[model samples]
Target: MRMLTYISVLFLAVLTVGCGGVSLPKEDIFSCEGFEIYPDSIVRGNRIYRAVSPREISNAWTLPDSTTVAPEFISTLPMADALFAKAVISPSFLTPEEIWLSLGFLRPEESMQALRSLAWLPENDNEDFPYSTLSPYWAAAAWEVYCATGSRTWLREAYDALTRMLSRQWKLNRSALSEFYCGIPRGVTEQSTFYPASMDEMSRFQTFSASVNIMRAYSLRIASRMAGELKLYAEREWEMEADKLAGAVNDCLWLPDLQRYGQYLYGDYYPIVSSVTDNEANLLAALTGTATPEMSAAMVGELPLIASGVPSVYPYVVNQTPLRPVVQALYGLSAAKVRNPRAFIHSMASVWNLSLDANYPSLWPSLVMKGLFGIETTPSGLEFRPMVPEVFGGEKQLRGLRYRDAVLDISLNGTGDRIASFMVDSVSTDSHSLPAGMKGHHKVVITLSGNDLNAKPLRIFEPVTVPPTPEVKWPTANDMKIVGHDRLLHYDIYLDGVMTQSISTDNYHVRPGECGVVTVVPTLERGSSGYATPPHVCLPDDEVISIHASSITPRRPPLHFIKDPATATNYIELAARHNTRITCYVNVAVEGDYFITVGYSNGSERCGIRTLGVNGVDVATLLFPPRRLNDWVHVYPSTTSVIHLNEGVNKLWLTYVGGTILFNKLTLLKRS
Candidate 1:
């Protein structure tokens, strides 16, 4: 009877495989000839080759060539986006409390840390929470990492942090509309200057931003997924909250006339006016499943705005090409996956070409794996539901993909829009799912046929590496002493003349018996075109040595002396009272006349006056003129003053005379 039962099960299994209902292990299922070669060509020798995009140049810092995967038939935009997302993992600019995914070419970690800081600051006892703008989509970025790496450890860590952040956000920012959340007050938002919403600068008070709420819902859904993996009961609450938020967004934020969601709703200020239509918000709605199928279709219909490429905003905000819209647009495209794959491919290619022309490294490659390849993480395992455009013919392969404990190498042979057959390893399979608990290397090859199929894969040439000019020179010990006025980009510090540490600071302290050589590099050269005025640097011939005043201890006062995370430097602020003063003790290595340049910001209408004194002797009354209100990340150069410093420790005093000013660092440069 037992033998009969085993035979019956065996028969069922064979029957299922024969009927194409179950996969059967087979030897040599298909040929690999059609797939494109991956790890797209990279220039070998480098002075820092200007790759087609900025991130491509920077990608060498993290992703070595051996680990990179280049899939053929993938256009440059999606390729660049994938590379940028991989490169964005860095230490948080704020407290290195946690790793963060950066927003863009600027400080990338700040993109998510800003939001985390805002949400967790009030709840945590830690006083040193770095001040950054609030971002609601941090979890979404984290989810990308989880999907790519398949690290349960990373997922758990991210899950805990996001849960705490969500709880705090609920407590502080949640709207009276139940699961809905309000936007940060404009004053606070302006201070951070990093919210993803499109409110006019004049928009007063807090309102419910559709983007933020959708982001919250998206994050909750991700958290719920993570919780379920850990078998945590809290997953129910997260799912419940996500459902409620989505419903609220549809019920309250949807705009009937536009057939899209409104940008924001005036919080409790009735008859609510929802005037603006944000391209990014609508895209997010589609990407996160907040939008209905009809809404998704309507949003996808706006692909015409990309005449040649995608714009940051539709209806064109003058001089605005924010990264959010581009990213969101790609997400929308991936989510919609409309029937006209050829049009989408053409539009994406156009955007890629445009990005190359502009030298902007947009993160478009994210669309390749997530959209075109249609790779998704299921509880069972990784699922591949590719949406290959018929235009991209021949064979395309994605190699060297790291997923948890496995390495996935995927190959697709396309003759047309549809995949005729697919093979997993040596096994013949028609299933879309790769069952869970897959270990080691796995390969999936899909074959398609149509009239438009090309015989060869599309090829993009590797960037040419231009050698540095003969005049280009590394800084010597003498050059290190000359402080350039441009923002200190980084420092290569050597101990006993051997490279030891690399830091982003103008100041360093040498311990006893340890000789140190510090080289400071600036963000731009003197002739760079961004600023109107050339930066003031000590002449190459100047007999100068700079002491980083920020490194010195300042005498306590009524004002706060805080480290500005944006620059990773200390600055003093909030000294509005009379008779307030900050004193820094500086050790002068040489006795000579020096120019004392204080980095500060005076944004108010009135000028800030301060008395500069050397060892209690008043030297000059320094005047800081009012400049336009700038982002807090900026530190402008103050007018330089000549002062004599005796060898050994010299006391420098900034006596408060009036007005408001943010004092960054003080640099003492010896005169020629």
Candidate 2:
């Protein structure tokens, strides 16, 4: 692989590929602007390319390509590398997640952001969106923001906002599964709660989600601490409430034998982990203090991972990327020299043909300030204990990091947690901290002993039990009405294998027109019920037709090979390599009317992402995770997505963002 520089103020085109597979950059480097590069410096890979800064150097962040900020850094770290800066810093680059992550480095007001899905909201109303993003992680994110800023004013405001939020929007949802508790509902997923069903998102399934509840529990604990510091009266109440939820999480969801929490639970005490892989719920359980120390220790000994990055879920219902796992688990596992998240990201992008930026900038700063550097600010003072992973086995430096009224320049040599020497302004200090009242620019240097951290090894990535792919049972034609189990159970209605509606026994409905092949998968509070559905024509109450891949394909039965869009006008074709700025047409109907699935093959190590367009507008970034190809003879993987269709014919365009894909066919299911 070689570096091919495409000079642009905001974009840096860095491609890495070899005959064997994806090749990583020779070195992971994010250097300070003051670091000089000669007119033509030699590098690896034949030393054929000239090394030059992509932009002018400044006292601010020196990296030539990323956002120019007040801080300066020269890092050769793995996760917290040069590309981290490029994720988001400029207002134009702001994303919902990035704004939360930016609080450590940028001003709070500058980082205030609205949901990308809700970007249509009015500008004046944008400021309020942060408080109402419908996520269980809000309180924890606010705590991190305060940790980075050390602002009492922000803390007080955050505390007040959380109080009101808990009373109103942030309160736990009522649950039927647990008779005594209300908690974060199932499918609360990530920070956002709504999207066109593209990846079997948890949001599409409403149940009791352990990950969500654990976050809610953690938030309450943080809120309680904040209240005590501020002398608020609700500290005890919130703490007790947090304890209640945390207890419920362990009692109901913890899979003791598996050493992890189940993904979710049904209303009547059925855990859904029988056929599911453990995910963020466990990380949240361990990190949030929701789990006991014993439970956490057990988790450290177990927890499996995907072939590349740690996946969100295994035997994926759809394409998945382990973004949360990387952010929350990697640093926690620094003692074990766990896999680097950046390597997975690059490898995934190499297959997806898209380099994602501005989505996770804050994660880098969080991992650095709170994980590797281990900077914690309290009323007493500030403590700094670097816990660099073995992957970052070298010296790294950061300049102009603002905390309170001080601008700090810190350098760490060697890696791991063993500290050999600590010095502030060339003056050695016995303690690894600074006075709270100390307010001045200072240079601090630290050296590691290069010995073991003495910390318990974080032995994640242990093999988890893989349950059988429970058989899917489709509703028979004998009944238009769906029935639940004699015991408490529910049903998931799938249109063309894409789940559309989940109905409980009490509120079953059979809407005849707004569906395709009708199959009802019986969902128990405990185990899997393999379900099936078949293609059935519904008279177009609104001119809707059940669409097959044949609607746009020239062949039937067997999925025809997708030729280049340039030549195959009638067949379903996507853009191939050497063809940028190309748009291919797969005119289906309008959205809110169809669920789409694609049959594909990916033998790479990492997950790939592709954009799905509704009409001509891009609605979702779909993931295509790696599967065993056995040279295209083994697995023919498939993923489902929702596409709304109009009353008449609608042109759904799948743009060739980049890279070549092995997608063969598109399956459309009519959706409500």
Candidate 3:
């Protein structure tokens, strides 16, 4: 596969060299390889890409690689009329987040229409959740809007919207991605298909991506900068928060061995090992400086490549693999900064190939202009810092480039990442920055300053090394040793699929014979991790097990054990607002669906509900109907739907969601 990629890459280099010396046409928009790319065409979608003509949406189009709106997405909805009555006034394409990053290459004044065409601050009345603000993707597009136009009016409006969204702080859904913390839950993010139903429920719960935390840090930093600009007093506070969050990400997600940041941290409080790395995580880590300079070097030097370009996530799983053009551009831009020309070319090739696969022949030319050519639209004018590779050797000219009221004809003659000389309309600027705000047609010329004497012949861009999956031994019924990683912080014990205990130290002990089977996952120091490792079920044993609530320890504080004539056993009293957790192991002889009945007392006027968890996975929501105010009830009043359980030890846990309820006992009966 490496040889094939190398060969394909070599073929591309040959084609590039063959076409290098030829003069490009004088077009209003950039053109190459028989394709025309107007700055607007990239987002509006050309005939070359999958152009949708949805009646409700504007003329703009979604990226061929992005989420595709179904043909009948709005048309097939039952209440389309009522739901879309407002959007009809100005239908928009919300698919402009990543695409916004490319706006950095176009002048702000000229590109305002394109920028404005995007569904501004996309969301419901008070719901403005931004992916870039929540996850780092290198190209800061929303920031480009102000940089492009230098409009303080737009800045103030955006600033206000940002403040309003930040005020809410992602409380809409308790598990939604938070702007200032590692808040998004794995169950909320992943679908059932992300992990098979047979797998341990812990596979995807309470997991938080490093990108979210890093993005929060970036958001705070940007907020601080903007606040200072807008004369808001909280700049210092936001700066401190940004620094703290960045430091936390460094402390938590670093994987020394891989020299990359782990995609996420799994588990609550103390996390288990989530030894996975994705393309987006690494790119963001490097681009945002979340990864140390040394770590960034390691990433560029050692991160492996997949059959396609950089795999969206390392260890790309079948069918679950994700592809996004925004992701590729960021990765390529990072490599460009590091002077690895191969990475940029390969990314462009990857996007070209991706376009072929999606049947969208045209690709984003900004990948070449903004990233490789290093020509950026600036508040003053334009900044030129070309990072030309050997393949693009010889003179290159870009004409009819729009900047405010000016049309630019930029000519480049470079082979390395430095400008030997630069001039705009016969005027010299030592800063290599020329004013685009000046009116009328203009000419800009730049030549490579660096010799690049040691530039190697074009070959394979990046190495392809697939890291081995990390594993740990399962614990036994009796006491056993903890298999630890060098960065190990703690360990979690799961029986069958239920998580029973979290061990913080070496000495591990549990009941023998009657205990459920166990599996273990490591917790890294200062970080959390988890596994999709399926639990072992179906042991040749069977019996009725009743777990008394009094024997269990409350996962949270301030719980009472009340004694009453309501039942044979005392019950654990969960306060009205205290969210408590009780974890237990259920040993069954047969693998089949079973009914779970709980003996509890709920005398409050309002009904109560408890979330039931099996193997650390949220399985069902249990309802505890209210009883009379004084009547103590404990006759197994609450029963759950028949939950499938493997023969052997399985986990059964309940979380106090609302109302006051006394947990007396939990009994599991095999369904006949």
Top lDDT prediction, candidate number: 3
Worst 10 residues of 1 by lDDT: 527-536
Question: What are the models' TM-scores?
Answer: 0.48, 0.53, 0.57
lDDT tens readout by residue for model 1, 71-172: 323333224443433433333343221111212212323433453454455532211111112355567666554554456776777788888767645523
Please state the error at residue 509 of candidate 1 in Å: 72
The CA lDDT at 633 in model 3 is 48
Candidate 2 lDDT (Cα, 0 to 1): 0.48
Global fold similarity of model 2 (TM-score): 0.53
Summed backbone clashes in each candidate are 17, 22, 12
Best by TM-score: 3
lDDT of 1 at 288: 73
Model 3 ranges off by over 4 Å: 1-96, 104-139, 170-180, 183-205, 318-322, 357-363, 377-381, 453-672
lDDT of each: 0.49, 0.48, 0.52
**Model 2 CA deviation exceeding 4 Å by range:** 1-69, 76-81, 84-102, 112-134, 169-172, 175-206, 267-275, 297-301, 319-359, 379-381, 453-672
**Candidate 1, which segments miss by more than 4 Å at Cα?**
1-134, 174-178, 184-205, 271-275, 303-306, 316-343, 354-362, 415-418, 449-672
For all predictions, the C-alpha RMSD in Å is: 22.9, 18.8, 14.6
* Candidate 1, backbone clash total: 17
